[model samples]
Each structure stands twice: as structure tokens, then as C-alpha cells.
Target: MARWQPKLGLVQETLLLTLHARALDAKLPSPILGDTLSAELAGAIDYDFGRLKVKPSLVATTALRARKLDDVVRAFVAVHPECVVLDLGCGLDPRMFRCDPPPNVGWYDIDFPEVVKLRSEHLPSRSHLIGADLTESGLLDDIPGDRPAVIIAEGLLPFMPGDSFRRMTRELAGHFPSGELALNGYTRFAAWAMKYHPTIKALGIKAAQGFDDPREPESWGAGLELVEEQFLTRAPEVALFPQPLRALTRLTARSTGLSRQGARILRYRF
Candidate 1:
């Protein structure tokens, strides 16, 4: 059988890290997200997973963050049954499968052309997969603008340039009638630290932008209001982690400052 080789750029290549993290988490005795599809997708690829040397804590953090995002999506979809869901920079991650929105909801996964092609060939999704770069103008025009929509940017924001990030947020806000934007956010310090992270450094990727305040996006001309800021280190899902990891998370959970330096999920309503 031929291995699934995806032609993705440097930034797009980072998707494999999250994919591997979810895959590793699924192998755990008590997995946080339990995404078997991610595991299968990771295995199907011919890339060298050993190069990443992904840590168990990183795996736990990835799963916990993903689970939180899934919860947010589920909650929104529960209320707005006819909403349009746009998974921006949607890589090979099977988030649509995990969320399983009602038939009334229109699900769309947007990514680079090659990545979308890879997804179509390997993953079975009911989502309308679009092949386009989010940074390009008129990208939002392809999506339904009249309906209420939920825009998810999981591991995407950090890699996007500051100007591009701001423009994208504002554009999304103006594109949809009303909805929410959910994403894993990084503080300036966290973004700097990412350069030294083993998996990140190995992939030769660096965060293009970061923010110290969760509410900072409100100034991006998006009319975005911070709905919630969920710090993963202090989340209940930490309890599901292995012994030392769980204890360490509990220790850091005591300080809001300390937890902010780690992974956080930010939700905004536009």
C-alpha cells in the first residue's frame, strides 16, 4: 500500500504535531479526547514520528485543549441547530466527527488545497471541504454569510502573522451574521517559548503572533467580545492525566499567571 504523503508548507506542516498528539492520547488507558480517527490518520502517514519525540504531558495538554474546544462547539451547536460551522485551517484533524453536529448544521472544513486533497483521500467527512488559503482575500465569500456561524481556529492563530490574524478576525466577524470564534491561544511568553519546544523546533515552525490579554481581539475591528477564557492546566480534564502530571497541574492551577503561560482556549462572540 502507498503511504499517504501530504504536500504541506512549513506552517501547514505543524498540523502533524497536533495530529500526533491526539493519536498518542488515544492510546492512553484513560484518554481525554478518545479520538481514534486521529490515531488512524497519524498511522496511515509515512512521516517520521520519532523526530518529534512528543512528550506525554504535551499529549495530555493537546487532548485536554481539544476536548475543551469540542465542548464549546457542542454547546453552541446544541442551541443553534441551523448554524454554519467553519473549521478554519482545518488540517487532518477529525473535529467534525468528534462534534457530530445535527443535520441542520452546515459543516465546512477549509484549508490549503493540498491539505484538503489529503483529507478527502484519507478521511471520511460529511463536511464540505474547501481548498483555499484563509490569508487570501475573498476566502470568506465562498462560505455562507447569511447564516449564524461558528468559526474554529484550533492550532491556527499562532502561525498566522499579526496583521493577517487581525484582518481574519475582523473579516470573519463581518462575514457571519452572528456567531462565535473559538481557538487555542498563546501568550507572548508562550509564543516565545514555542521556539525552544522540542516538537515545534523540530518542525522548524515559530509562532507568528501572540497576545497577553484574551480581550485584546476586541480592538481588532472585529467587534469581538471575549466570551470565555479557559486555561487548560487548571481544567477538570487535568485530573484525568497520569499521577505526577495531574499533581503538577494542580500545583500550577493555584496561580492564574502560571496557568496563562501554558495552553489556554479563548472564545469570542462577534
Candidate 2:
């Protein structure tokens, strides 16, 4: 059994941090995401997990975020059985396996070449792997435009850098005939705080993008409409969080302002 060692740059390396968080959650008595695939990948990767300093709260939030995104995928695929699913900045998350869409559905995972190479080394080739910077023009051209597309960004937003996020959204909205774009969003403060978040700080990650208003993207002129905003604090899954954190979440869940300071998922119709 050979362990696959990774050599990703700073931004790309954050994938492991997120991956390890889900792996940690899967080990719990009653996990939120129950992503055993991530757990197996974490064990096989020859990286120092301790250095990421992944805490229980991060694990809980990461899994919950993934669970929420998975729900979005399931719902979309149910409505549009012949739709396409795009998991951008996919890393080695095994979302295609988790979603397990019908044979008629097409799933594609996009990431940097290094990460995609690493994914091939560890996971089976289920989805089409596209290794190109999302900001590049004509990236989505290769994907079919005939079907509805469910685009998921996960933790890939802040890493988009500068105004690239704006351009990316417009491209996605125009590329798909119809569908939704879903991702874990950060408020202005939440995005700024990532600089010092324990796990993020440990990896020296600094995110530059954030929007306090979920509706702000609607103003991006991207032909996107706000479908729903799911703050993690108010999520039904928050009840599963550990001890003091769970109680604290219940307290803050009442306020969208406080909730936005934490984990929140945004979905939009195009």
C-alpha cells in the first residue's frame, strides 16, 4: 500500500485542510456528512494532519456544509435527471460518489492540474476531471450546454482572487441553459476572520473575497436570482454539533447577522 504524497502550493494546499475536516467528522459516533471516502483518502495521504490543527467545530461545519451542498445536488438531479453536475475546486472530496446520480446525469470535477493528478492517484475515475484555472476563458465550453447544470463551488469562492469571482459567476449563468449555483458563502467579516481562524492560520491561508449580503450577487448582473440562503446556525443539522458549540449556535441562529458571521450556504437560480 503506497501513500500518495501531495505537493500543492499554498492556496491549493487548503484542499487538504477541508478534506481532513470531513475525514474527522466521518469518525464521529453520528457524523453529519458521513463521508467515509474522505476518511479513507485522509488515511492514505502522506501529509501531516496535525499541522492543519483541525478542531471539532471546523469538522462539524465542514461536514454540515458538504451535507447541505449534497442535498442541493440531490434535489437538482431529481428535478433534472439529464442535467450536468459541476464540482469546481473539487479536490479529492468524492462528491460524485456521494451524489451517485443516475447514468443519464453527467458529473465533472474541476481543479488545478496538481490536485486532479493527486485525485486520480487516490480515487477512482468516476467524473470527468478538468484541470484548468476556472478564470480561463472557454473552460466551460467543453461541457455540454444542452442540459441544465448544477454548479457547486464549496470552499472555492474566496480563492477566486480579486474580481475573478464576478466574471466566473457571469460565465456560469450564461453558459448553462438553466440551473443553480450553490456554495458556502462568507460574509465580509467571516472572510476577513479566516486569516486568523485556528485551522486556516495554521496553514497560512488568507482569503480575499466576502459578501455580507447574500443578495449582493444578484446585483452582479450575472442573471442570477437568490433561491435560498441557509445559515449553518439555523440548520437542522446544528443540533448534532458538540456541547457548548451546539448551544451557542442555537443562541445565534435567531439572528441572520450573527449566523452570517459563521457558515452559510447560498443557492441561486440562473
Candidate 3:
């Protein structure tokens, strides 16, 4: 095995696939993710965004889903202007640039220290970057406790074990008096499939925790209540999906059972 150290920036890690989606959006008639920054970041990093080889269909799917997730976070913050928004395990995503919350909103982008060090080297200085491990770092203490909170966990849960996921949730709920959490829910099949997914397998990434039911988080603690469920297949965003696949995604989204098997974005409030 090659013993090369994995050198990657925070945005670089996320751009692995999302950058391809951004390029697709630029060529499409209608783009789901209107993130110009992602493209620019990919350029700044001199990354071969095109070679990601995310099929056009899958690229569109990811873009559309990302757009929807962006909307969810924006809406939650809008309602709670005093909210502290934390992007857990935030790789190299320029969400802060995309969302651009008001001056009073406290936004945090948390990730491994190595990733943050790379981020500091390439990305502009942002007040939100917290370099620490989500699993064990006592970083959340740095966040002010006086405000309401909103947590964004996109593409994060699958990387963590069930116990770690549960424990983190418990701590987060305890830290913030009241808040909302939005995350992409993975199914057991999705978790198993991740072990074989080409790019993921290449990175030696494995999925650890997945739930068959959207409401499964309720089992973890009484502090959370299921508020909304978003199945990508049914969302109007599917209209942006690449030609033939749009119909298929729409059909799958309409089926409650099938939707559960596919990627899901769920919300909970505490």
C-alpha cells in the first residue's frame, strides 16, 4: 500500500464529488446548487474537478439534494435569527459563503484539525472554522450558550458509529437549550453499499450508522422531535435531475417505502 500522507484542505475534501456537481450545474439549463464558490475553490486548489467521474445523473441528483439542504438550513436560521449554526464534520464545503447568514448569526464549521489547517492555508479566513474532532474534541464549549442553535449534519452520520452518533446528539441537545438538526439519513443498505462505492472505497471510507426509519432519532432521546422528512426522489428539485433519471427519481420519491431505502434528509427539533 502507498504510504503517502493524505493531504487535503477542508474544501478540497468536500469538493471531491461536489465540485463535479457544480460543473454540471454550470452546463445545465437549470442548476440545483447555485454555488459558484465551489467551482472557484476547485480552481484555486487546482483540482481536476472534471475527472471525479460522478455520472451526470448522479451529479445532478447530488446538486439538487444539496440545494434543498441549503434551503432547509437557510429557513431554520431565518426563523431563529439568534441561532448558532454548526456544520458538523464540515469538510471543505463553502456553505458559509453560500448561505451568508446575517451578522448576528453564529456559524461554525467543525472538522478534524488537519483539515482545518489545510483550510487555513487555502480558504479565506472565516470566524466559523473550529479545528477539532467531533467524536472527542471539547470544541463545542467554545460556542456561546446564550443563543438558540441549528445543526447541519450533511454527509456526516454515515462516518460515525451508532454509539458515537447517539452520544454526540445527547451532548448537542444538552448544550443548546433549543435547536433544530438537519441531516442526510442513511439506510442499512446504503451503509453496506458505501463499503463498495468506488470513490468511497478508494478513500477507505466506511459507513457506520444508518436508520431504516426517518423517525429513528426519536429512540435516542426525548429531547428531539421529528419535524420534517425530505426524500430527494419526490422533491420538486428532481426537475433539475438529468433527463431520463428524473422520471425514475420522481417515481421512487413517491413511494413511501422506496423513499425510505433511498437518501433521506430529515429534521428534528428539541
Instruction: Show where candidate 1 strays beyond 4 Å.
Output: none
Off by over 4 Å in 3: 1-6, 9-15, 47-52
The collision pairs in model 2 are none
Q: How many clashing residue pairs appear in each of the predictions shown? A: 0, 0, 3
Output the worst ten-in-a-row residue range by lDDT, candidate 1: 1-10
Residue-wise C-alpha lDDT for candidate 3, range 1-270, written one tens digit per residue: 112233674333543665556655755667778677666655555555444456766677667666777787799888988789998877767777778888888888888788776666656766478888677747777899778888888777877765787788888888888988888888988878867766565555555568787777888974889998888888777777776888888778768888877767889998
- Number of the predicted model whose TM-score against the real structure is largest: 2
In candidate 1 the C-alpha lDDT for residue 175 amounts to: 88
TM-score of each: 0.97, 0.98, 0.89
Q: Ten residues in a row with the worst lDDT in model 3?
A: 1-10
Residue-wise lDDT of candidate 1 within 170-264, one digit each (tens)?
88889889999999998988888888988888888756568989989989999899999988887878889898989999999899999998889
* Regions more than 4 Å wrong, model 2: none
Residue 35 shift from truth in candidate 2, angstroms:
0.6
Superposed by TM-score, candidate 2 places the C-alpha of residue 21 at a distance from the truth, in angstroms, of 0.7
lDDT of 2 at 135: 74
lDDT of each: 0.88, 0.90, 0.74
Q: After superposition, how far is residue 2 of candidate 3 from its true place, in Å?
A: 27
